[model samples]
Target: MDMSMVWRQWLTRHDRVRDALPAVPLIVIAVAATAVGNSAWHEPHWDKVVWTALSCVPLVVRSRWPLQVALFTLAGDLTLMTVVSHTSPTPAACLVAVYTLALLGDRRTAWIVGFVAAVTIAGVYSATHADSVVGGAGLVRFDFALGATVLGRTVRSRRDNLAAAKARAERAERTREEEARRRVTEERVRIARDLHDIVAHHITLVNAQAGVAHHLMRDNPEQAYQALAHIKDNSRAALDELRATVGLLRQPDDTPGSRAPVPRLSDLDNLADGFRASGLDVRVTRTGTPSPVASSTELTAYRIVQEALTNTHKHGSATRAAVVVDYGAKGLRVTVTDDGRPGVPKGAGTGHGLIGMHERAAAVGGTVSAGPRAEGGFQVVAELPISPRSRLTPA
Candidate 1:
């Protein structure tokens, strides 16, 4: 859209038009100077005009064959000086050719050609004009040739630097895009784990309570009503937790309090009560003074406990389970043990529950170990740092 950029684009699309631009002015100046000189001498110099035009015409292709064009123009200049005894002070066409060579050719070749052109032109002009080698027209023409070479090299360097900078910008943009995609993938995995834990835990309890209500309905109507009430409570709890978990995907600009509060260690008692309602005896004990921790660390600790108890309720033949929490100087240690026979084989079912617990622990720089106890039960123990070096924010 910029005017200068548009002009450059037009020029680039028409190579012959761009290349012929330099020749137009060079031809005009040389022909005009030749006519003026001939008029002053009271004679016609048609040969000088023709040769000058001939020399300037090769500039149209200077970019394509710079060395050949330079040589051709040099021959024309030498011919006008030696054979015709007519010399132009400027030698415009020859200088243009040398500049084109330096601009397009390799550095070594450009310097070699430039040096030869300067010395040869200056030497021949000096010899024909009988001028001093150091302080004369010859020296001035030599300087002009050197100046053209330097100018051409400078332009070439600037172009190369611009090209490199453009490449670096493009690469940086691609890196940012890849990083964004990686973060999105990590967030999706975290969300999936949360949804699984929420749905699985509540659904397992609902199934247990529904069976109790069905069996008691025929003979014990009052107990059946209690079982149905527990089912209603659990289903409602499941819906509320599901809404909170899915609310994590809400827009960031939404009010912070719009989403439900995430679970923490303080909610462990309520979590145990939920299991106890499903006919699993659960007890929780704490040692040492509880200290505040990062929200992410607390969430990790809570999820690990919830997942451990869910597994015990669904798979273990345990009537009683004990949860122990120790707030030590180094970190927080949580242990859940059940006095039940391990009904499920090792590496059983989908295995997502155990895997999710381990992942949550690791995300907060902690560890989880679950196995059958040597004394005859199953236990899940987790050790979590009080202040993790890094943690994944809950989505």
Candidate 2:
């Protein structure tokens, strides 16, 4: 708090100082010039002091009305010159006025103001003092050229640098907007994949149980009751997982420094059990001691296997399926294959299962391929990066 107070005080002092700059210099110059002029003439010094004090009035408005102040101050100097008749101290006044115009105005305008002040002052002095007229013109010309060229160039360079800085700021803002749009798009895609993985597999269970209940309803009422029970349990499980997945979107505090549940490799057993309960034969195998897989890769691998099994239960009457997990030097490789139904007995199913599996693999910077293998069964395979701490590389 003390530091903040000190900073505010410094800013206040700085503004006050800036407001007192060129105007202060002009007032100081006027008083000195008037004093010197009166001494040279042997005149009433107090009258000279009053005229010089009046000259200071123009300086107060120098920043807002620079050109006007310059002219007003010059008029006061001329009134002094009239009394002394050719013994005017107008050289000092003209130099300062020309500088005010050059520092505040554009290059072209500054040149015009400088030339007019320079030539007119020199001409008036020459007319009054015939012996040194040419030398006076030489000095006036040099002063005008330096103010118009050198000082004008400095102002132009500053303006150019300011414009370039504004352009760079605009470009950086545009890049930031584009990056935000891309993240939003990717997040929506991830949510869609999760929804599909959660509900699609459970739908397969519902269809199979409904079929069993219908076929044995009259002949085997006890078996039909078990099928209906299975259907109810499957539907509830699907609801719970769906709620868990989608609740992430509405949770208010899931930003930096927030806690949230994100599913990982440990959830695979629950997923396998859900399919097995739905009456499909499923076996899980592992090879080469497992290493930590990235969270994104782990979740993607689980979803891919779930979708592939759902396809088997939907499109094939296959009684058995295999889920193979392998760890290699470069990545984690997963494959789910089933000799669909042992002799086709059901209808075609959710045609997008393969597409969903493929998309899941791709989301984690991986690859997926699904098709009938040369050995006569359908196979779904995916490969993912193994860097446990990294999922997506920086764009």
Candidate 3:
């Protein structure tokens, strides 16, 4: 419809022809220079015309088969000079072919071809210089061939560097995506652990308290009422903790309910009290003054104790469980143990709980050891580091 638009469409549709556009100017220059040379030297005009045409025509397909085109053009030029004593612009066409060969061919092949072409042209010129009109220009032709080869080599080196840079960029992007996936997987696991700890701890108490309420409904009405009240309280607490854990999956702006505070080391006493109400005797011991720690670290400690106690209550035949926290000079150490039979409990589940504990501790550069104790029970111990700067600084 428009001139520029029509021109653009034509160029896009004829990519091969467009790539050959550069050869048009070289062909014109070669023909013109040859015509001028023949007139200056009083050479046979028709013979010069034929020689120029043969030398320049090969450049038309130079881009397709650069080395072959170069050799063909070089052969025609050498024949013209030696057989006809012609002085023409055929050397320019050969130079263009040599450049294309160096740029497109393999490095070793280009080097070999360039050397042979240079030597052949120089040898032919020396053998024919005595009778040839173009004999004096032999050195210039040799220089043109060498210069084109250097230029082509430089361009090839630049293209190689650019390709390497692009490959590195793609590799870096892949690495970033893999790292993001790893983080997401880790977050999902942490959420699952939190869910397990919250649900198991409260539900166990609810079941025990329900059993008590049912057993004492007639004989001890007051105690039955108290057990029912404990059930309601435990259920509400469970719901609140569940809401808090689920909130972590929500986007910051999606406010069905805001995130509730996570359970901390301070919450362990209340956590143990719930187990006590469920009829398991839970004792907590502190060895040193509580040190300041990261909120995540505090939550991890609480969950470790919570999961350990849940395992004892749910999986072991333990009547009593102990939780010990020691704020050692290096870090905080937590130990949970139970005086239960050294065997699996009634309804023991997939061992994800123990694995979850170890994963949690490892995340914050801590270590946990859990196994059957030599005495007569199960024991879990975890040690977490406390950064001195974080202890002194507020978050």
lDDT (Cα atoms) of all candidates against the true structure: 0.81, 0.68, 0.78
What is the C-alpha lDDT profile of model 2 across 1-395, one tens digit per residue?
A: 69988876885667534433444555565456545653373333556556555665565555567678667766765565455543344444445555656777677876776666656555656666563545855465446544644564577568778889999899999999998988777777667777887778888788888888898899999999988898898898787777766665765865533323455667667667767766787888888779877767777787888888887777765778898899998899998888763334334655666777766766667889887655545778888878533344211
lDDT of 1: 0.81
lDDT of 2 at 92: 44
**Predicted candidate 3 versus true structure: per-residue lDDT over 1-395, tens digit per residue:** 89999998997787667546656776565456555642373333565666666677777678788989988988987887676654524365677778888888888888887777776776677666642424557666666678888888889889999999999999999999998898777778778888988888889889999999999999999999999998998999998988888888778788864666778888888988888888889999989877787777788888899988988888888889999999877789999999987554434578888988887787777888998876668899998876522212111
lDDT order, best first, reads: 1, 3, 2
- Cα deviation of 287, candidate 2, in Å: 2.7
**lDDT per residue, candidate 1, 49-119, as tens digits?**
67777878888888889889888887777666676554544677888888888888888877887788788
* Best candidate according to lDDT: 1
Model 3 ranges off by over 4 Å: 1-69, 108-112, 115-136, 252-257, 342-347, 388-395
Model 3 residue pairs with clashes:
none
The TM-scores, one per candidate, come to: 0.84, 0.60, 0.79
lDDT of 3 at 303: 87
Model 1 TM-score (2 dp) = 0.84
Query: How well does candidate 3 score on lDDT at residue 87?
Result: 54
RMSD of each: 3.4, 9.0, 5.0
